[model samples]
Target: MIAIFGSGETSPAMTSVHQELIARVSDPQLNAVLLDTPFGFQENADEIATRTIAYFREHVGCEIRLASYRHGGRATALEFEQFLSRLGNANYVFAGPGSPTYALRHWHDGAVRERLRAKLRQGGCVAFASAAAIGLGAYALPVYEIYKVGADPSWTEGLDLLGEVGVRCAVIPHYDNREGGTHDTRFCYMGEPRLRLLESMLPEDVLILGVDEYTACIIDFEAQSVTVRGRGGVTVRRRGTDRRWQRTTFALSELSHPQVAPAAVPDSASGRPEPDGTDGSPMVEQAREWGAHGRDALDRRDVDGVVAAILETENVLNAWAADLVGTDERDRVRAEMRNLVVRLGDLVRGGGREGVREYVAPLIDVLLSLRGEARREQRFKDADRLRAILAQCGVEVQDTPSGTAWSLQSQN
Candidate 1:
C-alpha cells in the first residue's frame, strides 16, 4: 500500500492519515521508521528529525525510529546498510518534505529505490509526502531547479514507485497551492504556463496525478483500488485536459487506461443533503463549518487552528459579499463570524494571547512550583534561572501576597 500526501504530512490535518497507517500494523508496537534522506541536507536536520519523531509519538500516538541516511556519498558503509535494513524490516515507512531532485539523486546514489520497491512488493506500507511524493512517479519535477534557479521546465528520472501498482504517471504535490497570491503557483509552483509545457513533455501514455494540498491519494495494490481523502482531492491531467475527483474512490487500473473513471457527483444527487438543507449557497455552509472549527480550536487552545478557522470564515464572508444574491443565509453566516470574532477577542485579553495561557497554564503552574521549591532550599540561582527562562518566553511572573501570577508580554 502507498499513501501520497500533497502536503501537511506531519500537521494536524494529516494526523488521521498517520493514525490510519500505523493502526494497520498488527504489532502492538508499530515497526515504523522515518526515512530522513529527503530533508537530510538541512542545517537543522537533527531538529527536524526530533520534531517529526515527537509528532508521531505524541500526536499520532505511535513510536517511529529514524533511518538517518542524510547523504549517500558522505555516509559510512555501515550507516548505508543500516538504513536499508531498517527500512526493509519496518512494516511502515514515512518520508516527507525536501528537494525532489536532491531526493532522487540521493536515492539513485544510495540504491535505496530498489529497496523501497521491494518493500512495497512485500506488502509493506510506504507513506510519502511533498518532495518524497514527487520522486515516486515515472518522472519528477525539479522543483528547486525550475522554480528557484530560473531553469527551464524539464523532467528528471523518478523512482517509478507508482508503476508497481500499474499507475503510469508523474506525481505533482501542492496541486492547489495559492501562495503565489496575484500570480499562479499551482502545479508545484510550475504554474499554468510552465506546467502546460511540462505536460506536453510527458510520454503519450503517462498522465499526471496531481494531489491537492492536505489531501491523500492512497493506492492499495492488494485491493486494486485507490481512495482519495482530506480537504481537497485528486486532479487527473491527461492530454492537456484536467478532471477532478474529490472524496471519491476509483479503481487503480483506471488511472492508466482512463476508462470507467467516475465524475464528481452533486450532493443532492448523491444522497448527501446540504449542511442546513435550507440554504442553497455552499459558502454559507462553509462559513458555518469554519465557525464551528473556530469554536473547537478555542476550546482546545489550538492557536494556529483557531486563527486559520477565523481567517477561512472571513474569506468565505468576503466571497459571499462579492455575490449579488441577498438572502437570510448571509445574515446567519454574519452572526457566526461575529461570534467567532468575539471569541477571538476573549482569547487575547489582558495584554496577552490568553489562548496560549490557557494551553500552557498547567505546565506554567508546575514550573512555578519547582521554582518555589528552589527558593525554599535557598538555591536562589536555580529559582532565578527558572524566572529568567519564563522572562525569555515573554512570560512576566509576579509574586503577590495571595499567590504567583504570570502574564505574557504584549508584542505591541
Candidate 2:
C-alpha cells in the first residue's frame, strides 16, 4: 500500500492518518522509518528530525528512527548503502515536507526507488507526503526553480513509482493551495499560468494525479482500491483537459480508465497546516532597508567588500525559520512572523515574490565555502573562477560588512 499525503504530515490533523497507516502494517512489531532526505538541505535538519520523532512518539504511538540521507553528492558509498538498508529493512516508511527536486536528484540516481518499490511490492505501507509525494510520478516539476527562481516551465525525470503501479502521470500535492489569498497559488504554486504552459509540454500518455491539502490518497494494489481521507479529496487530471476524480472513495482500477465527468466542481478550497512550535533564540528585529542596503558594494574588484544582500536576507531568514516550525506567531505577530514554511506557502504565488528569494539559502553557503577555500590558499584564480561561476548562474554577489551576499538576477 502507498499512502500519499498532500500536506500537514506532522500536524495534529495528520495524527489519525499516521495511526491508521501504522494499523495497516502487517508486521507484528512495527519498525517505522522516517526518510529525512527530502528536507536534509535545511541547516536545522537535526531539529526537524528531532521534532518529527517526537511527533511520532507523542501522537502516533510509534517510535520512529531517522534515515538521514541529505545530499547525494555529499554521501559516501557506505552512507548510501546504509540509507538503502534502512528503507529496505523497514515495514513502514514515511517521508514528508522537503524539496521534490532535491529528493529526486538524490533518489532517482540510485536504488532508493527500487527499495521502495520492493517494499511496496512485497506488502508494506510506504507513506510519502507533501514534496516527497510530488516526486512519485512519471515526471517531476521543478517547483522552486520555475515558480521562485523564474526559470522556464519544465519537467524532470521522476522516480516513476506511480507508473510502476500503472498510473502514468505527475503527482502534484497541495493541489488545492490558497495560502496566496490574493494570488493564484493553486496547482502546486505554478498557478494556472505556468501550469497550463507545462501541461501542454507533457507526453500524451501521462496524466496528472493531484491530491488536495490535508488529504490522503491511499492506494491498495492488492485489492485494487483507492481510499481518499481527510478534510479534502483527490484530483486526477487528464491530459490537456479538465477531467478529474474530485472526491469520494474510488477504485484504483479507475485510474487506468478515467471516465467523463459531469461538470465536476473544481478543488480550490485549502487549509493551512497547524503550526508546530519550536523554541528559538531571540533574534533582534532590524529596520527594513532590504532592497537598498544590499546594493552598497564598495567595488567589484574589492573581494573583501564583495557581498550579497540576499545573504543578509538569508540571515533574517535563518533567524526566523525556527519560529515558523511549530510556532503560532500569526496570532501574535503578523507579516514578519511568516518564516520559511509560510514564505514557501505564498512566496511563489504573486508577481511580487519572484527571483531566487523563494529558495531561501540552500546552496549559497556551499558556493561561499568553495570561494573561502580558494582565498585561504591564496588561489586568486580559483576565487575569481568561483565569482564567474556565480555570475554565470545569474547570481549577483555584492559586498556587505558582515559577509559576502548574493541574489538572483532575472534569468529571463
Candidate 3:
C-alpha cells in the first residue's frame, strides 16, 4: 500500500487517516519506522525525527523507530547494515516534510531506496507526506528552488516508486496552496503558468497527480483501488485537462490505462494558455510574505513568533475571506490560508508535544527500572506503590519472561 499525503502528516487533522493506516498492519507489536532523509538538511533535523516519533507514539499509539539514513556517506558499514535491517523489519514506513531535491540527492541509487522498493514489493505500507510525497513520482518539482529562489521551473527525476507500481505520473503536493495571498502560489507553489511549462516538459504519457494540502490518495495494490481521503480532492491532469477525484474510490487499473480527453494545444504564437483569473492579489501576496516569516519562526523554534506570523496572515484572510468566497481561485486561496494556519500551529504544538513525550518516556523508564530494583530487593510495598502510581496515571505495566513492558492506557 502506498499513502501519499499532501501535508499535515502529524497534525490532529490527520489523526483519523493515520489511525486507519496503522490499523491495517494488524500487528499489536508492528515494526514501524520513520525515514528522516527528507528533513535531513534542516538545522534541527533531530527535532523533526523526535516529533515524528512522538506523533506516532502519542497520536497513533504506534511506537516508530527512526531509520536514520540521512547521509550514506557519513555512515559506517555497521550503521548502513543496521539502517537496512530496520527498514526490513518495518511493516509501516513513513517519510515527510523536507526538501524533495535534497532527499533525492541522498537517496539516489542508495540502499535506502532499494529497501523502500523491497518493502513495497512485500506489501508493506509506505506513507509519504509533503516533500516526501513529491519525491515518490516519476518526476519531482523543484518546489523551493523554483518558487522561493527564483530558479527556472523544471522537474527532476524522482524516486519513481509510483512508476514501479504502474503509475506514470508526477506527484504535486500542496496543490491548493494559497500562501501567495496576492499571486497564484497553488500547485505546490508552481502555480498554473509555471506548472504548465513544467508539465509541457514532461513526457506526453506522464500524468499529473495533484494532492491538495490536508488530503491523501492511497494506492492499494492488493485491492487495485485508489481512494481519496481528507479535506480536499486528488487531481489527475493531462494535456491541459484535469479530472478531480474526491472522497471516492476508483479502480487503480484506470491509472495504467490513460483516457485523457484531447484538447487543442495553446497557439505557439501566444506561447501560453490564457490566464484563468489567478493573477495579482495584494492581500494574498502580503499573506504569502507573512507565511514565509512564519515558516522561518517555526524553523527557529520561536513559538510566539509563529503565532504572530499566523495572526498576521489570518488578519489578511479574515478581511478578504468574504469577497473571495465565490470564485474558484479565491476559494482555493482561502482554503490554503486555513491549511497554512493549521500547519504553523502544528509546528509549535508538535515541538512542545515531542518535548513532553521525551521527558515522560525517560521518567517512566526510570520508574520502571526502580520498580524492578525494589522487586529484586523483595521490597513488595515499594514496588506495589510504584506500580499503583503508574496505573493511576494511565500507565499499564506488564511483566513478562523477557522483562517489564509499559504502555499508556488508551483513554477512550
Candidate 4:
C-alpha cells in the first residue's frame, strides 16, 4: 500500500489535491474503500470523513467506508476486526490525519495492522495522511517531542507489514509549509539540529523523503516508480562522510526498487537447522515456533501449555536481546521484545499473575510518575496512601534515586 501525507485537510486546496489523486487511480464502476484512522485533531475527523466520502462519490462514483476510530487505546474491539475483514475485499483504503504515536500505540499489532498488510500484499492501493503516513513506514516517529515520550523520539517498530521496504526512510510530511506550527517547519519537523540528530541515529544508507503539503510521493510497485504529484519536489538525502542533498522531480517509475538493497540477517543470527530435527529450524526459529504454539494453545483453552510456551518465548527473547546489546540493532531487538510482551499479555489475560504484570508495566510507569510527583512536593500522606492503594492492587513500590518504581508482586 502506498501512503500520502499533507499539512492539514482544513484547506480546500489540500482536499482538492487529494481528490484529484484518488480520481487518477479510481474507477467509477469499481467499489473502493477508504479507511480513515485519524488519531490527531479528532475534532476535525468528522469533517475530513465527510469530505472524503463526498470526494469519492462525486468523482469516482465508488462506495466509501469510513472506519472512523476515535480512541485506539487498548483492547481492540471485535467490530474493528470485522471492519478490516471488509477491507480485505476493497480496491482502495485511505487513512486520515492524526498523531502517529497515538495511532501506533493503539493500532500497531491489532486487527487494523493485519488487515492493512493483507490489503497491500493483495495489490490494493492505500493512502495515509499525517500520522497515518508515518504509520505506513517500518518505524513510528515520536512527533510529540515536548512530552516526556518525545525526549526519546526514537523510532518504535512499526507494523513491519511493509517489512524493510521503508526502513530508515523518515516521511517528513508537510515539509514546505512554513505557516504550519512548529519551529522545524522548513528544514525538519523538529529543526535542523534535531533532524541531524535523528539522521545520526539512523543507518548511513537511510533516505529522507521530505514531501510538501498537498503533494504526494506516489509509489507504484507495479510500475517500479515513485511519482510526485501536486505542488512539491522530493528531497533525497545521501549522508556519508558528508551529507549531500538532491531535489528532483519524481515520476511513478523512479522508486520501484530500494536505493539500497534491504539488509539481510546474518546466517549465524538466522536460526541454525536442528540436528536430527526434521523442521531444520534454528534457535530463533524454534523460539518463534514455540511462541506460535503458545498462542494456539491459548486459543484452544490449553492454559497450561500457553504458560509454558510464553516462558519459553521470553527466554528466547532474552537471549536475543543479550546478543544484540551494544550493537546498532539493539533498539530493533528491544522493540521485538516489547512486541513479545504484548503478545504474551494478549494470551494470558485473566489467566494469571504473569499475564497481568506483562500488560501492567507500561501503565504502572505512568501511575508511578503521578504518585512520585505528589510525594516530592511534601504530600507524603497522599503519596503513602496512593502507594498503599497500588499495593492493594498487587503492586509493590520501591523508592529509587531517580524516583519511585513499582512492580506487580502477584497477579490476581
Candidate 5:
C-alpha cells in the first residue's frame, strides 16, 4: 500500500488529507489509527488528531488511536512497540509531522521496530507528513539543521526495514508561497550549498524527488503510477558524471507510470541466491543476484557500482517491504537502513570532516584511551578539549560523576 501526502505546514489541510485518505480506503468500517509523532508543543497535533478521529468515526465508522509520545522526552522503546502492535491491527496509520531525528531516536530499536516491520509485512497502508515523510526513506537528510537549527546539516541513520534503498531526495514542503518573505524564501529550504552538499553525498544514479508545498506524489502500487494529488509537480534531478545537476520537471501524471524494469542477474559464480519456488522465478532471482553484487561492490568501495546495486536491490526490497511488512514497517526499516547508509557514507568518505565525528564505537574507543592515560591536569584539559571537539562534530558530551557519555545533538 504505497501512499504519500502533503498539506504544506497548515493543520487544516493535513486534517483534510487524513480524512480523504481514510475515506478512500476500500473498507470504511475498518479501524484507522493515527500515530502522532509531533515535536514539542505542537499546537496543531491535538486538532489534527481530533479531526482525524472525527473523520474516521463519521465517514469510515471506525475508531482512531491518537498516539503521542512525551514532549521534550524520548518515547520508550516499549511505547513504540505497542504502537506498532496496534498498527498491525489498523486499517490505516498516519504519522504526524515533527523532527525526524527526534522521532527516529525514539523508535529505532526494540519492539517498536519489530511491530512496524510486522505491519508492513501485512500490507497495511500508512501515511506520513513532513518530518515523518522525510523519515520514510532509506536515508533522511535532516534539513531542519540548516533551515531552523542554524547548524551544519548532516544525515543520520534511519530505520532500515526498507532494506538497501536510498531516495537521495529533497522534499520542500511549501513550494508555492514566499510566505516567510525573501529572508525566509523557498530557496532557503533548497539552498545552493545544501543542494551541492546533497549531490556530493549521493551517487549519480540516485534520483531526487522534490515535492512542492500542498502537493503530494501519491504512489499506487497496484496501478504502478505516482499521481500528483495536490497543487504541484514533482521535480527530478540527475547529477551527471561531471558532477553537474540536470533538473527536469514532470507532471504528476507523467510519473504515474515511469518505466522501471526488473533487475538482471550478474554473470558470476558467487551470485545471489537463486529462486526455489515456481512463483519466484527470473525477477526474484535477478534481484537477489544484484543484491549480492551490490554488497560486493560496497565492500570494494565502488561507489558507482554500489549505488547501482543498491538501486536494483531496492526495487526488489520495495516489493518485499511492501508485500511482506506493509507500509509502516517498510517505512521504519527504511529509516534504519538510512542510518546504516550514513555510517556507510562516513566509511566511504574516509570518516567525517570533524576529527571526533567518527562512529560511536570508534569515538568511544578514542575517548576511553584518552581518559585512561591522563594525569590530573592533563585529564581535565584532554576531557575538555575532547568535549569541545565532539560538540563541533555535532555530539553532546555529558560528564556524569561515574563517567562521560555522549549523544548526537538534536538535528532540529
Candidate 6:
C-alpha cells in the first residue's frame, strides 16, 4: 500500500493519516524509517531528519530511523550499501517535504526505487507526503522550476511508481492550494491555467490524481480500494474533466475506467456533481457546527466540553475528509480545527496548573500541622529545618498569632 499525503507532513492536520499508516503495519513496534532524499539538498537537511525523528517518537509514539541518502554519488561504497540495508529492513518508510526533481534524480533507476519496490512486494507500506508524493506519478511538475525559477510550465518524467498498480497518472499534491491568495496557485503553486497546459502534454491513457493539501490517499492493493483520509479529497482528471471523491469509499476500478462518467451532482469545489449520487457538502456543514461548538466550549472554559467538541469535529472530519471540497470551505473548517486545538492546549495547561496547586495544598497543610506539633513540643531544630525546607521550595511560612500561613512564591 502507498499512502500519499498532500502536505502538512509533521503538522497536526496529518496526525490522523500518519497514525493510520502506522496502524497498517501489524508489527507491535513498527520499524519506521524516513528517507532524507527529498530534503537532502538543504543545508539544514540533518536538522529536518532530526526533527522528523523526534516528531515520530514524541507525537506518533514510534522511533523512526533515518535512512540517509544525502547524495547519489558522494557517499562511500560501504555507506551506500548500509543505506540500502536500512531501507530494506524498514517496515514503514516515509519521505516528505523537499524538491521533487532533486529527490527523483536520486531515486529514478536507482537502488532507492528498487528497494522501495521490493519492500512493497513484501507488503511494506511506503508513505510519501508532499514533495515525495509528487515524484511517484507518471509526470512530475517542476514546481520550483516554473513557479519560483521562472522556467516554462512543463512536465518532467516522474518516478511513475503508480504504474506498478496499473494506474497511469500524475500525482499533484496541494491540489487545492490557496497560498497565492491574489492569484490562482491551486495546483501546488501552479495555477489552474498552467496546470491545464501541463495536462495537455500528457498521453491519453494517463489521468491526473490531484491530492489537496493536508489530504492523503491510501491505495490498498489487497482490498482494491482507495481510502481518502485528510482535510481534502482526491481529484481524478480525465480528458480535462475532474471527478473528485471525498470522505467516501470508491473502488480501484474507477482509476482504470476513466470513461465511466461521474454522477451529475453539484460538487462543492467546482459546483459540479459527480456520477455517483453522493455529495459531501452536508458533511462539511456538520463539521463547521462542531467547530462552532468547540469554540463555544473554549469560551466558557469548559475543558471536558472543549475536548468533546473537538473530538466530535475530528470524527466528522476524518469520516468525511474525502467529502470535503471547496477550498474556501475546507480552509475555514481547518482553521477552526487548528484554533480549537490551540485553545484546548491552553486550557489543559491552565487546568493542570490549578490542579497541581489544589493537589499540593492538602500536602502543605499536613506538613504545616506536623511542623506546628514539633514547635509546640519544643523541637526547635526540627521546626527550623522544616521552615528551611519550605523556603528552599520557594514557599514562605509565616508563624502568626492565629496560625502558620504558607504561600508559594510562584503564586505571587
Compared with the true structure, all predictions reach lDDT values of 0.77, 0.68, 0.75, 0.53, 0.49, 0.74
Best by TM-score: 1
Using lDDT as the measure, name the better of candidate 3 and candidate 6: 3
Model 6, 1-412: lDDT tens per residue?
A: 8888887677556776788778888476688888998889999788788878877776677788998888887878887888899999998999998899998987764677778877667778889988899888878988899999999988888877788777888999888765554566677887766776888889998888988777789887777888888768888887668788787777888865655454232333553222333212345566778877878877887766665665666566554443213466565654565566566545544553345444345545655765787799998886786676556545579988997898765532
Could you tell me which 10 consecutive residues in candidate 2 have the lowest summed lDDT? 278-287
Off by over 4 Å in 2: 243-247, 262-412
Cα-based TM-score, every candidate: 0.68, 0.65, 0.64, 0.52, 0.50, 0.66
Tens-digit lDDT string for candidate 5 (156-253): 66554333222334443333323333232332264434555665676444444455555565554434444555544444444411111112323333
- What pairs collide in candidate 4? 40-98, 224-256, 225-252, 225-253, 225-254, 226-255, 227-251, 271-282, 272-282
- Where is model 3 more than 4 Å wrong at Cα? 261-412
Candidate 4: tens digits of C-alpha lDDT, residues 105-210: 6675566776776656655677776666766655556766533355854666555543434334556665554422223334325544455566677665455556
Selected candidate, larger TM-score, 2 vs 6? 6
C-alpha lDDT (0 to 100) for residue 129 of candidate 3: 92
What's the lDDT for residue 350 in model 6?
A: 54
Give one digit per residue, the lDDT tens place, for model 3 in 192-298.
Answer: 77777998999987899999877889999888899999877888888687777799999997766656564333454543444554333445556677777877876
Whole-structure CA lDDT of model 5: 0.49
Q: TM-score of predicted model 2? A: 0.65
lDDT per residue for candidate 2 within 1-412, as digits (tens), equals 8888887677655678789888878467787899988889988788778878888887778899888799989999999888888888888998887789999888865578888888778788889988888888889988888878998999998888887678988888877766555566677887665676787889888888888776789888887888888767777676545545444667887876677464233344422322223211122222123313433332222211223433444454443432222333222221232222222222223233334353435545655665787688898886787676666555578868987888766533
